[model samples]
Target: MLVPTAAGTPAAPAGSPADTAPSVSASTAVAQARSTEVEEQLARDPGRFRVLTGDRPTGALHLGHLLATLDNRVRLQDAGVDVVLVVADYQVITDRDDAGDLPAVVREVVLDYLAAGIDPARSTVFTHSAVPALNQLLLPFLSLVSVAELERNPTVKAEAVDAERRQGRGMSGLLFTYPVHQAADILFCRANLVPVGQDQLPHLETTRTVARRFNQRYAPTTGYFPEPEALLTPSLTVLGDDGAKMSKSRGNALELRASEDETVRFFRRARTDSERHITYEPERRPEVANLLRIGAHLAGTTPGELADAVGAAGAGRLKTVVTEAVVEGLRPLRERRAALAADGPAVVRDVLARGNARANEIADRTLADVRELMGTMYS
Candidate 1:
């Protein structure tokens, strides 16, 4: 039994609609107020700050991705943030045994970005492999951090263990040192802010450490790289149907581009307990709670509110409601995706090419400055 917060709210059990409603209203109001504050903050001088965020091109974007980070990116862009969205094609091979259909996967990722409301004209969207300077910066960045330091990164260790468990083998050297490469990705663009979830704080800290060390060693008078800060999102942890963290390989993800039938089938098959009543007791009933969270996110309300609205409705009714809300919420995105897909790959290629050119120009200037700082700019 998870204890409630300072608000004296307990977990809504099977027959406690009265206790749940006020808590729901209070939580929803707080969340709304905080969101408004963030929006107000972003609206002021977003153009002065450079923000970099991205995803590994392992597959298309999913509902979890949208709730966790993509939505924040869109908001930032709309508020005039200088946004650079990276499709990390190179990182796909870091832990995986195989890079599956790299080109097709990358293109699909871009389409998903476009569908998710990332305007290419507003936000620079480029593939990691297309930016040569990013790779070039990695050599020097790697030298700044030690093997022990790399091995100690919690994100790298967790990812390596998961990969080895899946593949039944050990990870490669590249997988172990991937965080250093990530540092290069951030510093190369001189991005001042990186939007990330709480679980990714360790990686962002590593990036900050690398930036600080590089500046102190090379250019103490004036810092060459900005010590990028993590813009931690409030709703970062989105669980999958199995009550575990949402991931593509788990086969529990709700893909953003999933068909109407597929979406229905996915939610219909969601795992809930034998107890019929829908309640918001995550610690005790995670599967059903996960569905409630998804539904609340889609319906623009709190999970407690959603549960109260359903009253004593059983799991079947809850599932139906969640499925409808998800389908309806994703309708516009799906329509946009279909229209973009119909335009074929040429349009996506053009967007990527233009973004790549812009990224290259900025990266080149940064690299030139780094070389000059290190006294390696002979020509």
Candidate 2:
């Protein structure tokens, strides 16, 4: 039997409602519902299922993040979709006004992805520096999304207002305009699906908005910018040990590259209450509940099963179990990374070559359509 979590606690994980499978017929009755669910989950895109997603090269990816981006990237590739992972090396300047680690950061970030099972051959992972035309598309998109619109953007507001309130460098124009670059990233390749977290819906919304407006204004009225649909990830909002958002800058992230020693230390410092038992109750036992959740995820069992396995050990032992599970879980990543980083420069170059070739072929067609719509078509 599952040990009781603290009383009155909720069971919903982030991005997951209490509802899992709704009571509905899987026959004719559910066809519309299923279709809508799919369209809502993915854009009812008639074009290719190419998925475009990228990261700002500010830091390394953590396990909490791997549960979202890296894993999803691999899944989309297996489904026969063209997947492009963009290394937003240019946008690093938005958060910090420095160029100190630009090349090093890009190199490290690429190696981290390779280590994390982001295959360069099966999927195209390339740095922004390698693709110049992508940035060029930004000029047009910038003209579409207004400053007021960008200001109202929840992400920019969170970064600039909420974060800057703590006395860091305030948000810059580049950060506010990062979405334009993102639109360029997707539309440059005419991507059809973009996988992202819930928080970035506004950014993706802006991407779609830019595509619509740009195609209306510049592309063939039939459209050049494929209004990219979002492939909403199932899990998001993975909490830090502190019970807040997970981020490297917040000092709240545990990197995928963390040594076993490092993983053990981080989990040990994770906050918990005076409650003496281990439970999966998130509402009442949020801190400990999150630990159990992560452990369940890495250990390949339900929280209920893990609770039973760690039976009666309470929070201290639960932490130990989670710590060990994470270390073992990430060992493959560490080893694969070591092998790749030995020839890191070559690996990055090859990824870029493949991505550029694929991206350019699509970009050329999209641009031609844009010129035709804008009446600049070279007859």
Candidate 3:
């Protein structure tokens, strides 16, 4: 049996209808409606929504994180939504065998979060391993999905290829089922809103599928899980100094934790066209526009305005403006981060402890509900 959910997708039985695999255009239209609805609801009653979003601790966060999602995470939290930030430590090994500097990287991630204004009091910041019950939800979630559906996920396919390339071996089973793990993360808290970029819509779709199927099969009347809606990020993609997506591994990223001198050095080596006339034409002049966008973000103005302000000054003057903006804008965060770093791991440990405690509480309750619904509450 199948029923249409509020999101306009049919809640067919798992693997049935092949999900009817709506065409890209159809799915995008549905997603657009949901996004609009979510925004409207947020404007009226933001507190009613819970947001789940995070990053892996595989690398330090960079400018892209700031412009894309971290800033918005703070905005949503301040707007009274319950924000749950997960440091996906377990996922670090999905591709690589050893993240040898796990402790250091996790600490760095926490530091970045704190520095980025993710108040530990307002948000729950937890790691994956600390809450075993969360991962336990995976088994049931996995059952609600299928191998073919997992294979069909474009994000999974891309990551799997990248993983194999990095490891020089076939993708791991964990990598194949990564979207399901992400589903567990979302539904564990029953988060109804997830902030994501365009490329991540497919992963969010998988979460919605598992949530819908689980409710239909296990708790039809109750609708135990929310079909999470994507709060599509409005920020433009922050490109690298080299005109591509900012990436730390590629050495094109300007990390949030970088020293002022480092920031200057990065822009110093940045690529820009020879045109002395400055303008914010991302499509035609991506290199120059990348710098302008970054500057505009820091200066609290539009890229075009920044460009006009620097009109005829050329790339040299533009880089200097951006460099100064970055340094001055990041000053307070750097100070806060330095203070946090000085306390050793005390602050990080405390944040994780509180966050993990709350996560376990929520996860246990959700797990119990699932067991009761499935008639598996043996205890």
Model 3 regions more than 4 Å off: 1-19, 160-168
lDDT of 2 by residue, 1-379 (tens): 1111111223233223222222323322333333345444433332246778888888778877787688677666665667888887887787776767676777777888777767777777777776666776777678877888787777787787665676746677778787777788887877767776455666766776776666545532244555655555654556776768778778898888777888888898888778776777777877877777788877788877787777677788988999988888788888888788787588776767887676666666766666666677667
What do the candidate models score in CA lDDT, each in turn?
0.78, 0.70, 0.86
> Of the candidates shown, which would achieve the greatest lDDT relative to the real structure?
3
lDDT by residue (tens digit), candidate 1, 10-103: 2223234422223334634543454455445556556666788899998888999988788788888888898998898898987767898999
Candidate 3 yields a Cα-based lDDT of 0.86
Q: Residues 116-195, candidate 3: write the lDDT tens digits.
A: 89999999999999999999999989998888889889967787667666745778788888999999999898888899
lDDT of 2: 0.70
Winner by TM-score: 3
TM-score of 3: 0.93
For every model shown, what is its TM-score relative to the native structure?
0.86, 0.81, 0.93
